[model samples]
Target chain A: MAASASASAARPLAGDSLTIHVSSRPQLAMVSALPRSSPPTWRLGLGRPARLSTRSPHARSVRCLAAGGGLAPEMRATLDKVVASHKVVLFMKGTKDFPQCGFSHTVVQILRSLDVPFETLDVLANEALRQGLKDYSSWPTFPQLYIDGEFFGGCDITVEAYKSGELQETLEKAMCS
Target chain B: MGVTKEDVETAITSSLSPSHLVVTDTSGGCGASYEIEVVSEKFEGKRLLERHRMVNTALAPHMAEIHAVSIKKVLTPAQAQPQPEPAADKAQA
Candidate 1:
């Protein structure tokens, strides 16, 4: 065991174990579902995707739910960029119109009633994304809200914020700029 | 199977040692949903978001089995005392 350990230790750079996910998978199904161009390069640790960042008028943020957790290093960067793209982003169980979960629906209603122009990503559509979000936010629940690139909270918090008019205040701040 | 109200209370009590706790089985007959109200000294100076996060972390072991968790309220003992909300709170609204 010691001999093997020493032999492997001699292997330089092989033990980085950074868990980098250069998704050379060519055809990521989730990207295809997106309305606009979501070139894999944007997530390929490149600046070209930053160009997609500026070019994304409205469609990108709505569908920009990247996977997290085990395959998160690259996905995390992508998610950061995605969250930054929108003033209000909701990572929920379903879209704005039809929410699969009650908690998600409640959040949707709150956002709608508040008249906050937000984007929603249905987590049910992607297994990796659904699982990754639990790890990413550490909240372990759906209907997670992000305002101004910061995680706001889940349904209960949103409800509380809405009642306190804090949600309105926060949305105003986010939308103002 | 999902967790019961007792299990949730036990978890929170052991982890946070809250001064007050109320766990409601909002899942009706099922054990999937719960509404939690907790008051802990640990919440002193913490924002509502952090308090809720602490409660959620306490229940992390059972998160997969349990479905929805609505943290109805989280207060420090001082805040939980018999008193009206501060005027500044109303001013924000």
Candidate 2:
């Protein structure tokens, strides 16, 4: 609590609680609102209304496929750097020649059909990168396609984008850069 | 025999100690495509990509049996919440 005061002193609050500290506030409120004898839901109200933040907890359960790589914290940072390293990168299940997963194969096919040149990371070989990717993209599914070092979407999104020619357009822009 | 769902769960639970965990059999029964959602302290400070990597690593032994693994979400218990609809998804309708 004391640390909060120091932090608050540095930045003025737009609301009762500082926006930066909003998440922490909910956790704290949830702690104190606990009545030793009351029902759990009563405690729920006192805390910050559960936020449906962009990052959802259940995001990873979107598809039931096994991840292939090991993603350590440092490896995660490295992966981020790597994704940012290239203009176009895809964290796919397999490589361009032999896609291990159907979703991955779909994206590879789409990329090829578009005549786009992109780098692919085979998560199967490395464990750390695979696990780290789930968190980095905030996506629950695989066949994650990145353009200009940014996550475009998963296989489904890629397929749709390819159909509409958006995927080709985006890749064209990336390749030129 | 390929890796089983129970094997994947055990690896994840043992590695991440997630507060919430959901494992789905996308393969229908063959154990190929699978999806998982895990909320754990291990995910704190890590980004979405990294969190996925962690889950992937935990399931390494079972990877051969898996075909398409989709991670719907990975978050710290504190960060865990329902997902927001993507802007494109909203626009498409």
Candidate 3:
């Protein structure tokens, strides 16, 4: 019994370190690739699936490559697919249940209060996606809400829209569509 | 070091030429956060997202240092005008 408990505790610790190692690998690649003066633009239009099939391991590396060379067209394609994946999508700092930032949390709460089913992408997990999204939306902040494949706005706009009843109206329309 | 409230105001003023503007430093002297309310003719006919984009673009230079920007309000001069309250008249009736 004692040995089993010790092993179980060690298992979680090993898993935690493994996760940290995997996540840090991409950051190291990003830092190294940043100083390369000439962007590998030639890598464009090659080997990248127009849409990521199932959040493959290659996704992070692809995003890292894209981030290194500014907003690559491939990155734009991926973002396009992501935004259009659902009727309501929120590219936020953290997941819906676990928002890392205050603004992100506020928006999550508003959406929850509205009782609308939405999808959230955690930008904190993926640095490349975070940078890519900033360029993709051209909006400087997180908690970017998208309704019906449109860039709705950030937290403040969502709150204002919620207050003014416009968000519900728009959501109704989107749901109907 | 981060951007000042005055710096944000100047950037918005020069870019959008707002008739009314308020920039509040919400970062407790760190200057990394702000709450802005801008009323400009440039916002006329633009959607809320576009208006916010205008503000973001205006502050693009300083956005790196600034952590949070809550654009509380973005309105055209016309939209900013107080509307006549018809509810008062109805109540009197």
* Candidate 2 residue lDDT tens string, A40-146: 22111221222222222322221222221222222222333445545667777777788887888988888777676667777776544565566555454577887
RMSD of 3: 12.2
Docking class of 3: medium
Fnat of candidates, each listed: 0.83, 0.00, 1.00
Instruction: Score each candidate by Cα lDDT.
Output: 0.66, 0.57, 0.68
Candidate 2 lDDT over residue span B1-93, tens digit each: 656678778999999998877777777888777777677999999755466668877876676567667666577867655445343243234
Clashes per candidate (backbone, < 3 Å): 0, 51, 0
Better of 1 and 2 by TM-score: 1
Off by over 4 Å in 1: A1-71, B83-93
Highest-scoring model, lDDT? 3
Runs with alpha carbons beyond 4 Å of true place in candidate 3: A1-69, B83-93
lDDT, candidate 2, equals 0.57
- Return the TM-score for candidate 2, rounded to 2 decimals: 0.43
Candidate 3 matches the true fold with a TM-score of: 0.71
Cα error of candidate 2 at position B69, Å: 8.1
**Model 1: how far residue A28 lies from native, Å:** 14
Ranking by lDDT: 3, 1, 2
- Sorting all predicted structures by DockQ, with the top scorer first, yields 3, 1, 2
Q: Give me the displacement of residue A139 in model 3, in angstroms.
A: 0.8
**Candidate 3 local lDDT, B1-93, one digit each (tens):** 789989999999999999978788888999999988888999989888778888988999999999999987788878777746342343234
